[model samples]
Target chain A: MSSDRIAAAFARAASERRAALVAYLTAYDGGFEHSLSCLLAAIDAGADVIELGVPFSDPSADGPTICAAMVRAREHGATLTHVLSLLAQLRAQRDTPVVLFGYANPLLRRGATRFADDARAAGADGVLVVDLPPESAAILREPVRAAGLHWIGLVAPTTSAARCELVARGASGFLYAITRAGTTGTALAEADSDEDAALRRQLALVRAATRLPVVAGFGVRTPEHVARLAPHAEGVVVGSALVEAALAGPSVLGASVRALREATAR
Target chain B: MLRTPVDHRDDDAPGSFGRFGGRYVAETLMPVVLELEAGWNAAWADPDFRSDVARMLACWAGRPSALSPAPRLAQALGTAARVWLKREDLNHTGSHKINNCVGQVLLAQRLGKRRIIAETGAGQHGVATATVCAKLGLPCVVYMGAVDVARQQLNVLRMQMLGATVVPVEAGSATLKDAINEALRDWVAHPHDTHYVIGSVMGPHPYPTMVRELQRIIGAEVRHQLHAEVGKAPDALVACVGGGSNAMGLFAEFVADATVALFGVEAAGCGLHDRHAATMARGSEGVYHGMRSRVLQDDDGQLLEAHSISAGLDYPGVGPEHAWLHECGRARYLAVDDAAALAAALQLARSEGILPALESAHAFAALPEVLATLGFDRGRGEGRDVVVNLSGRGDKDMPTFAAQLLARPETP
Candidate 1:
């Protein structure tokens, strides 16, 4: 099962006494062929899980870097179906667990159930729609898990403990603890500040509420950001930094994810 | 002190417009928005807050703007309809947008936020937001699409003169949709000290519901004024819809009144097929700007750029409540092309000496199509009463109006 794959990835990282490195890259960001090469490179460089960001025209929750990447990806003829096809091709080559990430409109345009089943058939292990909170997720949640794909939940510092429990109810792959209360590429606040102290409290709250492994993300830029997260959560997701690297080329993205991978050591 | 803490145990905060409106934002915004929802609920429920908003509307926004009888314009259209104009254009900010701006600005104060941000398409809302912020001594930032900033230069200058910084967003066709995306980005980054005063009855829950409540003063006044003038319910209520705030403001009072007919006219830039903002005619049901409304989107649900000579009406989606009303057949919606709206503006200016905002001209253009149906022709005496919401004045649209009409002295 997909949940077992995600759990095994976490357990494997734990056996090595290190937090897992989940690298993110937009499918078709540079171009379909370029993105595929970068994805294969990141996986080869020891990324425990891969988050394949499906390009969208209006990515409201993202910062400028990811937003621009999505625009470039769309210009390259990206779509949910096209990204799923990319996923299928990647699956033919590798066994790394992959999560499909995007907003709700594109997934909803394809019909929630249809998209979930298609994503699963494409060998997707999990799904995370940024705007589909637990309140508005009813239409997509059941179909997502029933397709044998894990349901990943995002918990922010602003989310109260009870809401964290509500999110963890159906969550499977992992709980994403937002390290900051901003979009995807804002700089994470310095430690010892009120925001850093608040994030620590949120991690404690999420830890108390869910059995699902918590992976802190949002604004995570460097190995230092991953190292900061390693002590508090089970994993770290490097998104914009890796995306910026992929735009530079495949080798730069490989070196970037590898550096993040090394920072996961306990 | 925060008026409302993020203490929600669930996602059951108010602001659902019958399955169309809900908080569909990211988790980072989810809790803070819930706090906003709670703050709004408490503020509105208090008699003090209600009175404060009412006082501001009357004193600052020029509430109870006269319902002028436009018999000359009505007769020129060759309809028997006795047309009355809800003169929202005469308000302090030259539009009905001030109603929402003042309300949201006050809400921000009560919530203890220090900065104000807004998105504007035509700059009317931006001007209104800047006006209110200036009065209240809050720093204001307005996001406008680069396309709009170029066209609506007068209003842009007005906002800058009012001490608000105007930002021209260059992303995504560089229009209202892009401006809104930029505003949402700004909000998420500075959630603790910022309040996004959404200018229309669009976006996610709470915003749809909140904006509707703020603008409802228009319809409420129309009811009392029409009652005193003609002493009966109107036969039909007409307004132009961009994001549909002005129309919803006028229609909210009459949705429960079975005797009144509601008509919402959308912009057809040239024609629906070639270029237009007629979401009701061409859009499919999907989510945009936080609400599930009739949206102009491609098959993949990517938003399509809307076109209208009037920048205010060039939006890709309608309000969620308007969507529900269309779903249940409570209102009739149709398209009014740019040429027709241009003619309507010329007719009103010649007949009644009033140049309406191009957005408001769309409502006037629909008067002919709707009045004949209500038996408001020249000879008919019964069921001839109609009210058209002139949502704003034409001062800001003079450049576009002059260019479109082009010095043809004789009225079309």
Candidate 2:
């Protein structure tokens, strides 16, 4: 359950022309069993990684659908512990790495060190504390590393080269490059010259700053977006595009995994 | 006069009510919200302040707004409960919101502050603030939700006309709450020179208290007027609760009056039974902005998005003191749905020729229920006096009201 193992899985998936499908499901989005069904479906549909969102009181950077999903999850009595238990179930079934994606509250509420230990024990290989940046890395990095978990940091296009280099130095496993300034689940349309240039420069800066690989995410809807991002980073992360597929399909969870696999192949 | 809490005593700490009001902001802007809070706090304490406000009310804003008695409303409800509305609609700027904004802006001038910043929900406060800033020759920056700006184009134009800068926040839900977040971020970014005059009685400690104190002028005046007319205070008082500032302002004067019932009506967009914005009826103790108050939160304590026809009352949370009063059983919380509030708005306009602000109509809608609680037949002909704070005028809401009316020709 080390973070290194999780990064390696993604690295392999990228090299094989098979996307590392990251299926997103809030624990107890419906019932516990329904949540388990979604989890199982994602795995069966070829998702290499599953990102379980730990619902919180305030999720500042969330889209309507994801926000609604989080509401549904909380309504069904899901907590950080509940999410970990579900991840434990998945780990029992397969060796696929599970990533815990959430804001800092639940993690802080759960006690960062304790959360890291529990996440690793419950089959989680890495953690993405969305609000915490390199400046505040001490909040989670040491504990995560001690618990044999990867600390994945997102570098936005707006981030400066110095900050990007700092992120690279602090990052373990791989660096995540968030494509935009806003929240999740929006489509990638046009790019600003300054932003695109800054992202490329940041990637180069990250490469120079650390040995870890960098992955680009946010608005990677199609193969074109992937192709555009692939040459610049180690891999591409498609969350909203796959989420859209899940939402459109009869089996949202299964469709997400399949859409990602197909999109990466194309 | 009943012994108000020591902290609640007027002129105790210059701008403070108890431990509540003080300047809590970044060091740069520490002088601004503080200087303004202090100047206004001191000015309102001056006997001249009340007279100046009164003079403005009469000559400029057309004050002594009619105390319209809703007789038809009284007759239909089968009781003699008289509904006397303080016609804030008669004010030049339309709503009672200008009452606070004008006071603050005048005080801002006294403090040598040249700029004002504020956040608006439905653009009522934004327009009011912009108006005051324009009249006082002060620069104003009003943060508003992009969605609201699009919907409330007239108000946006009004603000622009008043020479206030409108920054449309495109973040989060693109609503009042997001507008507030953007405003706070702006304040944090430029705390040194700007005075952030909060629109409602929410935010941190001093804000909820200070705003209520400023707004108390409404209830204080109403209390004297009602006393002169009826020989005693009305049996019940009602006001709409967004962040509950209006209600808090009106209710504060009567909190110690055990016999005088106070009612705070929340916007139940659908119903309180449904997932609506009835924070007092449906919410629990939670902290947001600065104060620990009742907020519309889901099972995991996540703040739920609130829905209401009135943008001012569409907030997902109630003021901390309102929450505390509810807990102490000093005030009753009622839910007024969007349809009910709209109906009340139109009814007031048709009956009294007073087009009430959407938020104020929510208070009007709850009058029927409050009268019923006071042993009068609901919505009927009783002479039992009930004072409802008509917080604002409906001019700003005309476009929205017309649109809604056009969409629902069948539903009066």
lDDT, candidate 1, B89-142, per-residue tens: 999989999999999999999999999999999999999999999999999999
Which candidate number has the best DockQ? 1
Instruction: Please tell me which predicted candidate would have the highest lDDT against the true structure.
Output: 1
Interface root-mean-square deviation of model 2 in angstroms is: 8.7
lDDT of 2: 0.70
- Second chain TM-score for model 2: 0.88
Q: Cα miss at A65, model 1 (Å)?
A: 0.8
Per-residue accuracy of model 1 over A1-266 as CA lDDT, tens digit each: 55577889999999998999998898889777898999999999999999999888888888888999999999889887789889999999998999999888889999988998999899999999898888888788889988889989988877898899989996888998888877898788797788888888889999999888889888888889888888888998889999999988889989998899999987
Predicted model with the maximum TM-score: 1
Q: RMSD, model 2, all Cα superposed?
A: 9.8
Residue pairs with clashing backbones, model 1: B80-B376, B80-B377, B80-B378, B81-B376
lDDT of each: 0.88, 0.70
